[model samples]
Target: MGDKVVKFEPITHVIFDMDGLLLDTEKVYESIIKKIASKYGKEYTLEVRSELTGRTQVDSAKIAVEKMKLPITIDEYLEQYHPLCREFLQTPDLMPGAEKLVRHLAKHNIPIAIATSGNEWLSKIKTQNHVNLFSEFHHTVYGSSDPEVVNGKPAPDIYLICASRFPDNPSPDKVLVFEDAPNGVEGAYSAGMQVVMIPAPEVEEELKRHATLVLTTMEDFVPETFGLPPYDE
Candidate 1:
């Protein structure tokens, strides 16, 4: 008899969504955005952060400009915030169990990739020298030139692109995605990957619909529970 395919497949590749998922960087990022907006006499709020999550900077700036009625152009907004982004990289913190989870997945020989809405230069700062955690595990990394082209999060373009980048293993179904925001989780779902969410307190309830699995911390990620093999590499 042929081997039966389980309804829920085991994860073979792990595609990580950066920003809120792997790093506790969202609050700082929001702070910087607010700081930049304030210079234009616009009052940005936490609610705006939720709106901007997973969007490209260009798209985000458009929203900010339209909703907040900012007096500045997107270019002017970028000028204010981009420098803050670079400065923010001076300190980086790993999300709970983020390092352990990546190392665990990598130790098992699971191919790892990064899909983010951040620009290449800022993304490198976040992944490479800033935290020193993600640099070790990610085999491939991708970021948009501008957030609008791929529709950013709540769309699958970034995740699909990351899946396509895996030269030796290109199947989207073989991947597990880790996300922390509703947009990111939805993107992973649209990309046809198993999604797990480790959300912050603010968005925990809203994210339930998008996640295949929800946990407070990455420490809960046990391979056996999900029918994945132990770390064997």
Candidate 2:
């Protein structure tokens, strides 16, 4: 036998991690983070961003304040950051291939839901302009705001919660997760779900090792590879 044939285990449902994955809101955070860092004579670097990515809002604030030595309490940091987030994040652009893929999945009746580290309020602001697209989701779990989610990404709570809310709670192995952050990938992986990561260019290769698959962008995703319905061209 030349090569052993590996059978594909088709995923029955899908969960999406938002922020840098679905909405192009990471840049908004970057701009604000850099502004505050510069004010404190601190430079917000890629390493710091890597740690904050996929974390809950409170965890992100704590990490930023500590890592950058911002000389501000986490509450104070949020005081300055939240208003700016509300302002700049209102009209966020969709990440490449976001709309097309989501729409295609919804059109094909595939069960899809969003699991985001952001709270419900910020989510509403970010998707204010894309109501039609977001409406297609079976449901959305807000890690920071949902009391049911005791922990955020990297803990598997959010993804598990998202899956449970689906009409028929899909098993871990039957849920395919799409993420753009290492923490989110870890969360999905720890939940025993197959994950496809589309990480930032700055993310190191080692950090991507846990993903079931990795792609440069959502545009590169071929749904049929995971048994998702292929788009009708």
Candidate 3:
């Protein structure tokens, strides 16, 4: 709010959203959903896929079925999607700057965490498959299927829970959140943290009101680029 630029030195921690932010896995899921919908004679449009961007699988399923007026039920959607996520995770594609950004942050010893609405299976892919990439982090918060704990994106419960886990540094002002969706940006802002919105071009307007700094991609997130300290002396 004070200065639009993020001087990262004063920031004590970084919280990342795993899907579109850290991995290029969102498109995979979108493809899977469309394929499934096609097989079942349901229409899965790009507009619908865009709407489901930052939601949990279950919630998205609900929207697809109830809100979108699809023929599938929530259980049926999960039945189709669970195995799809597992298959997708078996060979995930990392977002362009994911490796470099995490390595740089780790080298500088910045405390980091992954705050995702994804469940255990996706978390396994992110944390275990890319263990070396994020093993240095303190903890990971994979919000469960419990409705109370997870209102999903745009509601902010998940991000708030992630921030509260760092009670020693509870005030969100000390943290910087990295997000790739407007809903994620809203959630981080709702949690009271400063957020950098790195959108995927489809949802640039989603970030307009919520983002502290809106950028096209994470490729530009260098520590020194933001005037933060370099890892080496």
Global lDDT of each candidate: 0.75, 0.91, 0.74
TM-score of each: 0.86, 0.95, 0.86
Please identify which of the two predictions, 1 or 3, would achieve the higher lDDT against the true structure. Answer: 1
Instruction: Residues 1-233, candidate 3: write the lDDT tens digits.
Output: 44456444357778898888887787887788877777767887757766677877777788777645767779987898888877776667778877877877888777788788787666776556687786766666765454556478877787777777764655677778899877778888888887888887766463457787777778766555444566453
Candidates, ranked, lDDT? 2, 1, 3
Question: Highest lDDT: which candidate?
Answer: 2
lDDT value for model 3: 0.74
Q: Would you list the clashing residue pairs of candidate 2?
A: none
lDDT of 2 by residue, 4-118 (tens): 3534468989899889999998888999999888988999999999999899999999999999999999999999989988889989899999999999999889999999999
Model 2 off-target regions past 4 Å? 1-8
Worst lDDT window (10 residues) for model 1? Answer: 140-149
Query: Can you list the residue pairs that collide in candidate 3?
Result: none
Candidate 1: deviation at residue 98, Å? 1.1
- Clash pairs of candidate 1? none
Residue 212 displacement in candidate 1 (angstroms):
0.3
